[model samples]
Target: MRKLLAATLGILSAVGGFVDVGDLVAASQAGARFGMAHSWVLLLGVVAICAYAEMAGRIAAVTGRAVFDLIRERLGARVALLNLVASYVVTVVTLAAELGGVALAVRLATGVPYLIWVPVAGAAVWLVLWRMRFPVMERVFGLAGLALVVFAVALFWLPTDWAALGHSAVSGGQAGQGWGAYWFVAVALFASTVSPYEVFFFSSGGVEERWGTADLADARFSVLVGFPIGGFLALALIATATVVLRPAGLTVTGLEQVAHPVVLAFGGLGLAIAALAFFAVTFGAALETGLSAAYAAAQYFGWQWGKRVSPREATRFHTVLLVSVLLGVLLLLTAIDPVALTEYMLIISAVALPLTYLPILVVANDRTYLGDRVNGPWLNTLAAALLLVILAASIVAIPLAIGTRMGQ
Candidate 1:
């Protein structure tokens, strides 16, 4: 049962990575505009995230320290501080986008105006972080998020062209949409899949739960199972969009449009499920980004952190958590479209990918930290190869966004 409970951390992390507000928009848009042309990017992202997250989990388990804790020690204060600033800014922006997503999800379920729910969603998420136990918080939202599987079920109910999707997945193309736009969307989707906050939250959660060497198998299992499940769910989103929205030449302007395939398959029942899934994923991710922002700050400053202690004891950590949530609420109250905010956030995240990931690779290879448990040759090779891809995405993200006017 303990092992079973441990899986929820990966599930919640994957929920934040693959099906969060940004992914719902990016994945659906990929399918709608270019069919499955961007499928390879998603697959690549899953591989990269799973590999890095495993390294992170192992570091937490073996060293009895979180990634950021080691990062500061290994890379020196200057580089780590730069990474922290970039990561923190991007994470807080992500938190705001997620808060807006929660409000948007509520508006979909009820006819309430979105702005009215922004603060309400912020308050609810803050309360959950303040009151909920770590394991229970992870388990509840993680399980609820599986409701997105309805999109996969919709694939069978609809007349999906399986062979066509298979062909598109392999024979990647720009679909005459210009390579600039294609690559822009690819970067965005990749950024959504391997967001830095996911790793921050994953490693911190390991520390929060007191994982040790004995828990390595459970951590690996969570990484192997949880992220692939997220990739599959994300693929279902792409496939559904390819089947329904692409054919209709529809644009994915909002979450409701993203759910249209499911709605077509089961009508009102599908909408209900999609709404719940949206709320679960967005709300779950809000908790993750909120905590991740706090964790990164606390870890960097060498302040006391984690949920293992009382709020009064971890005053600085809890204060950062509160302030982050308030910032999210304030950002959302400005009424920026959550989907648009997600696109911009993904672009910035893509540009900052190297700052977050390169240090992980360096730390994972350092024998001082992992000793004999350090990454093997094959994993290092693969991780290095993926880092090059991350660098390329970072380099081209802005140019592609500008050339394509944010994918037109």
Candidate 2:
């Protein structure tokens, strides 16, 4: 049971990573428009995230240094600071979206408006980060996120055409959505599933937990099992959306629409469960992004971080974390639609993909860092192929968004 609990920690991190608000919007959008056509993207993202996460965890265990630590050492202080700025911006944007998601969830459960709940949600998230033990926080949110499985349950209860969903997953046609729009959705889905904050949080969490060589196996189990489970849940979200929303030609613009499939199957109760899942996953994601912003900054500057020390002890890290949350709150106060912010975040994440990834790949191969634990020939080949895809997505993301007018 003890070993199982540790394994569960990894799964918790993956669940937090793969299903944040950006994904809640993107996955539902993909399913509603392209049906299961982009399911492969989620699967590909799962594989890619797991592989990279394993490497990051391995490096953390063996080197006793988190990803951003190695990132600074390799990319040097100046370049790493630049990476910190860009990544911090992306992480903050994502944090705002997730906080909005929490508000949306609260609004669904009660009749309160989302705006009313926004500040409340942000305060509650901040409190959790401030006082909660890290592992306990992970377990609670991770388990709550599993509530998303209700969507999968709704599928069986609803009149789902499983065979057609299978066909679409294997065949990546546009289903009349147009190739331009199809690719746009593809980029969004790719970016959400492979959000860079996941890496920052995962590697940093390993360090916070004091993972060492003996803990490598547990870390590996967590990434391999946990992230794939997250991908499966995300895949289920798309499939449910495809089955219920696509024929109506409905595109999701908010949380209510995203939860429509579940509502159709189980009415109020399903809606309740869906909302709860949204709150948990998004809230969990908000914490991760907030910390990731601070992690990137502190790691680059070679300052102390993590909760092992008190806020005063890691003053710089805590200060950055607090500021990051405030920035997210202020951004939302501008009344920009959080959903729009989420979509835009995904695109920008696509653009900055290489900055986070190239450093990891380079560090993963460093003999001094990994010793005999470096990636093998075949793993490197796969990483290269995946890197090519990431580059293509980054390069075309902007052009496609423009040409498609943000997928009209």
Question: What's the lDDT for residue 372 in model 2?
Answer: 91
What local lDDT does model 2 show for residue 78? 83
**CA lDDT of every candidate:** 0.89, 0.87
lDDT of 2: 0.87
Q: Report the lDDT tens digits of candidate 1 across residue range 1-408.
A: 865655666565555445688888899999999998888888999999999999999999988888888878877999889888888889999999998888888988897889999999999999988988867777678888889999999999988788988898889698888888888999999999999888898888888878899988888888878888988889899989998999899998888899899999999899999999999989989999999999999999999998889899999999999999999899878888888899999999999998878888998888988899999999999999999999999999999988999998
Instruction: Give the distance in Å from residue 199's predicted Cα in candidate 2 to where it truly belongs.
Output: 0.5
All predictions: root-mean-square deviation over Cα? 1.5, 1.1
Residue-by-residue lDDT tens digits, candidate 2, 208-276? 888888998888887888888888889888989998889888889889989999999999999999999
User: Which pairs clash (backbone N, Cα, C closer than 3 Å) in model 1?
Assistant: none
Model 2 misses residue 174 by how many Å?
A: 1.5
Worst 10 residues of 1 by lDDT: 10-19
